[model samples]
Target: MDPTHSTLLHRLLDATTWRAFDVDAEGRILAGHDASGSVQLVELRPDGARVPLTALPGAVSGRYVPGSRRVVVSHDAGGNERAQLSLLDPDAVTAPLGEDELTPLVRDPDHIHGLVEVLPTGEVVYTTNRRNGVDFDLVVHRLADGTETVLYDGGGMVGGATVSHEGTRALMTRPGRPALSSQVLLLVGDTTTELTDAGEHARYGGLEWLPGGETAIVTSDSGRDHLGVAALDVATGHLTWLVTDDAHDVTARLSPDGRRLLVVTDDDGASRLAIHDADGTFLRDVALPAELRAGVADFLTLPRWSPDGTGLAITWTDPATPADVLLVDAERGRAGVVASSREPLADLDLVDPTSHGVPTPDGETVPCFVYAPPEPSGSSVVIVHGGPEGQSVRSFSAVVQALVGDGHTVLVPNVRGSVGYGKRWYSLDDVERRLDSVADLAALHTHLPRLGLDPARSALWGGSYGGYMVLAGLAFQPQLWAAGVDIVGISSLVTFLENTSPYRRAHREREYGSLERDREFLERASPLNRIGDVRAPLFVIHGANDPRVPLSEAEQVAAAVRANGVEVEMVVYDDEGHGLAKRANRLDAYPRAVAFLGRALA
Candidate 1:
């Protein structure tokens, strides 16, 4: 009777992750992201084309500097946080800002990415750390003279920095200790003031400055039990809840114009998008096609907004198909599919156009996505998507698209541990079955080579748990792959659950078994304990401030992987966790990845 997720799944199909829209000062039809996540920028002109100034892996957290002639995207280059400040005129290619002038800086293994905002006076203001159980500070730098000063430390957990339209003030959210709760803070020229004290651990998200810095729209969960949109008076530090809810929770996002608020919410298991006036009056429920809402048990969960303000983009899923991006219009009430997301049965190396899906270790057939260039037999990079619980669907992938455009076949697999299939299929790699996922990946070397994928030129790639799979495949089946990459993967699961973030603290018990309760099972699941058998080229990337796996997880593996004379390459972003957020970091990671793949896969 229930083909679609009738619960939380439907609500979250839209905002399964975070996204930011880069509208011009006029908020016109600029180039926006369908699946690029929150990583782009656009320079709007009154007469000419609204140029999208967004650098790939661009500045998701950078502020605009007046008359600077360009925007700064921050990330990590090698070991230091590097800024890719691209000029907007022709394209977003410009010189990169190094750490010569910025100091007291840290590139912790967990938190490694930084955000930049160039001031009219040639000062670059940026957030300097991660929300990884530590407070963050906003520091400013003078380019001409090379002077640095702390704007406001804000206790270390500050995020989402927004400058006033007039460029005099800034708005940011600060998280308190214990992790779940936070408050809003406003920074004046020389003074740091607390903005709102909603409650203990009240989650505040995405603070947007209004026409000027006089006011801001801050999203907060009323009490973790309620969702509301509120406006704050920067002068008085007063917050007036505009949109309040007690029934089903919602997250508020201010539109580009600041006149209307976009609210993402869910009721029961169905997801719905609601538009409301700034004063809290309901506008309209953006409509979704029946088919789009099929298995989307969490609708309010997936948050997406069209650049034109006409519709919301969300992940529409059903039992028959994995969730994919679908455009939904609130005015027209129509939903249309945009992309395909089915995992293939074989290694999909573009070199061999006819390559199909491959058989798994268990004899079950599953789909595989390929990453390679136009040449039928050039270098190859097989990227196994993370989430041993995830799938390699035809969804919007930023990295894959760019790589494919650059002439490389990137293979993405929806292994057995992945969802989109029924629960039984998703539960395949839990506990003792963990190695099954590894086996599925190892088989690719044998299977892909037969299908024309030059195994000698194939490299293993993935992040998080997928990163672990990369290490395992290389260690257990060295001859099967040319090289491997591990991005914050769990080389060891025995301590993963104990040291992991509270949000995911208990997640491993059911998947990998409890260390205290099932030591043997946990030991078998970890590749770190058995690293001596590994012999392959390995490159690892990790966020220093990562709260999930912690930087130590990667360091432990890196230390061992390097000591074994396996030729180890490592990149760590001091201020990032999980994924690369700042523009500088993404750009840094991309080129390094390209080089790493070239050296190994070549």
Candidate 2:
């Protein structure tokens, strides 16, 4: 590797970013800072002092206990994704958390027990699969008596649980028919009722109760193409659409007072934040910084309101800046960065991607973000995002920046199966139509020349489902891609469904087609079945403890391709599961992959 490229990759991989997840009444922010090399929960005090909270091996996520000074910390062993819940007292700890300091709330490694809500009455409402490995049940653990009550055991997956303000009722979300659509089940005293019709094809989530808990605000696309914020009546499953948009999906966050609402619109992967009254009357649009976007997806980051509702704390990011917490004055509609991690690369100029829509063979347009370097290198990379349901948003990425810095044009596309486009677009590649997404890669390659890139020197790169796309692209269209990089990808859908975690199988099968019903189709869709056609040199990365896509997937495909006398490089991290979360591992793995791509493309 060139000395300058090596230094650039090292610096980009080592750059630390801070994210604020929750804030308290005292203005203390519970933030995720990777200054310790791994993301750990740190208390950002109002006095500008940062106090380390938990120092675990895996990345930690946390939220402050409602109406209490104590915090609930959630972490997993390595990258297994079976997150365990623990509690910590930030006021009592002056240093990083010791082994015994974290009070075990739910500590079982065999199954997942996720924290839903910590009520003021010392009851923790969580979902766990302790009853059986496949199904998740909502249970309320009372800290006062050490007793537990199963709130809703109506089978399938308890996607989410939220307790009412009075603690007399709860709402649990269950997976709908297509898995993308979710149905809400309301629990009042001992009776449970479905808030959403079982026959509907809509998705409902982001449920927040108003003052008395009689009516709650939720984001739903029940009878529409795009998601919009609506108010749902608890007594009857009546929905009153609040913020409806013909073009984009909008999510709403109610203020602490329940008087104001902060609504965010997903305008083609970017965020547009606005404030609305309780009745959905438009107040004013928040004047955000140019190109600085707020949370587009709930999991990416959420805009949190202060306990008093006077200020808002949002995780904002642009192409050059990492996710940072910005405290906004709700009354004035102005914001400033309260916690940031942009100092490390302050002087370095990073590449910014321009959004474009590549036309597919069927006249459908695939949205893509292209990162072109200032000088042409004749080589380009097509990076696919994992979540067949996930979108490639305009967020900060060190890998894209490093690749562009090394003179490689990168194209990030949201194919047919990607979310944020609409229900029709996402469902296009489901089950039997799986290979249609793989075809999008060839379309992207054909359009590379329009962007001043040589189609013959292009490569494929992705992780998880994206990794599957990479393998599929190289295998299905061998002559298009020069080389390919797959990280934690699925090689065989048949083996993937067979070996993936039990709890995930049924849910994933809804999208990929079940093993019992569609075994032959899965075998046909698997990249391993067509591995003999893969002429490009390949690099595979995987995690040994991956529960979703087992290590066998990577091993089988690499071995099969190598048998054909093709060059193959494989790297497996014992400490990782789905993807590389540790900085040290990323610094080690990404540099080699980039070098391989450089040589292969050359």
Candidate 3:
């Protein structure tokens, strides 16, 4: 690796990202940070002290049982994402929980469990696909006695489940076939009722049970372009819109007393957080520190409100800084850093990203973030995001920043089928329409020269689905790109759907189409079939243990492209699952990737 690029990776890897998962009754924040290389759980005390809670080897995230000292932590082996629930006692002064002390609540090898919630009764409510291995069902687990009860076993994907404070009722969202459209179901003593008939193109999520347990607060896109907060009556299945906006509004956090809500609005990719009464009366926007105001503040975990409801905990990140956990006072809206992994970014000169909208031939607009080097390097790289359903948000990215530092312009585009936009925009590239996203990529390449970038020297890069896009671009429009980089990306849609983790097969097939119904379409969409058309040097990266995309995706693509006399470089990490999680692995892999791209583009 080049010394400059190696130094860039070193700096980027040094800054650890922290994610605050939950807050305990005593106001201590449970956060996951990469201070030890692999992400581990740590407790952030109010007095600015950090306590290591878990010393596990994989990514672990947990939440405290409302009134107990025990925390329920979820861990996945490698990155296969078949997460299992484990109980840990943070108060125990012993050197982290030993393997014998760690108690596994739901440990099924072939199944996956997630979205855990602790009911007031001390029963853990979580979603699992253990029944049929495809669709998820809600399960209530009694941690005290190791008893499990299937709460709701209905079909489709159980997006999430939330139990009421009294444990008498629960809410489960079943996302419809088209993807974003969903139906919210109310669960009462052995009976489930549909609370909202959110039809096609409408999305519903962020379910929270309000006081008295008769009503709940949820964010829905019914009868609107963007998601807005609304209250649903459990008895009547009626919705009363409270906070409607042009931008997507989501319920971030609710106070302990259930009197206040922290609503987060996704204005494109940047986040705007505001506090509101449970009845939807707007109070004021939560003022963020200057650093956090520049980029995205992730509210996915739901803000952790102090047990007393006087303070909230949040995670924030930007182009320059990795994620940091902060504690904010509820009354004055003042925020102070609780835990930050900022050592890695101490003195690095980082580039600030400028947002742009590129127009496609079909009259659709794709959003992109451009990070340019100080000195114009005619060469450019287009980094496609994974999740034909995922959007390119304003988050810190080490690879993008490093590429820009290496004198290459980086363009991260949120193409047609990305979220953060409305439901219609999100479904634009589903299944048969996926190639339309490839066209959007071509259009972005055409528009790059306008930003003083060289169209002839541009490279296409992405991971997972984005990796598929890189291969597709190289094959479909061979003349357009100078090189390509695919990280744990799909080479064949049919093979990917067939070989992906069984638990995720149904959900993924919903997005990419199934082999039984859309075999021909899947074949036509796969880049493997068109590999002969690729002319540029290709670099492939994959984790041997990846359960999502699988290593074969990279191996097959590299072998096929190499057979066509294309210069192909392959790197596979034996211990990694999906993506590189350990800092050492990242430091080893990323610089080589930069070196490969640097040599190819040069």
lDDT of each: 0.57, 0.86, 0.82
Candidate 1 C-alpha lDDT tens digits along 8-108: 12222222222222222232222233234333443333354434444343223233334444344443433223333222332433432233422322334
Pairs of residues at least 3 apart in sequence or in different chains that clash in candidate 2: none
Predict model 3's lDDT versus the native. 0.82
Model number with the top lDDT? 2
Q: List the candidates ranked by lDDT, beginning with the highest.
A: 2, 3, 1
Descending-TM-score candidate ranking: 2, 3, 1
Clashing pairs in 3: 14-344, 15-344
Q: Comparing 1 and 3 by lDDT, which wins?
A: 3
Per-prediction TM-score to the true structure, in the order listed: 0.50, 0.97, 0.96
After superposition on all C-alphas, the RMSD of every candidate to the true structure, in Å, is 12.9, 1.6, 1.8
What tens digits encode model 3's per-residue C-alpha lDDT throughout 122-146? 7998888878887788988887788
Q: Which ten residues in a row have the lowest lDDT in candidate 3?
A: 93-102
- What TM-score quantifies how close candidate 2 is to the native fold? 0.97
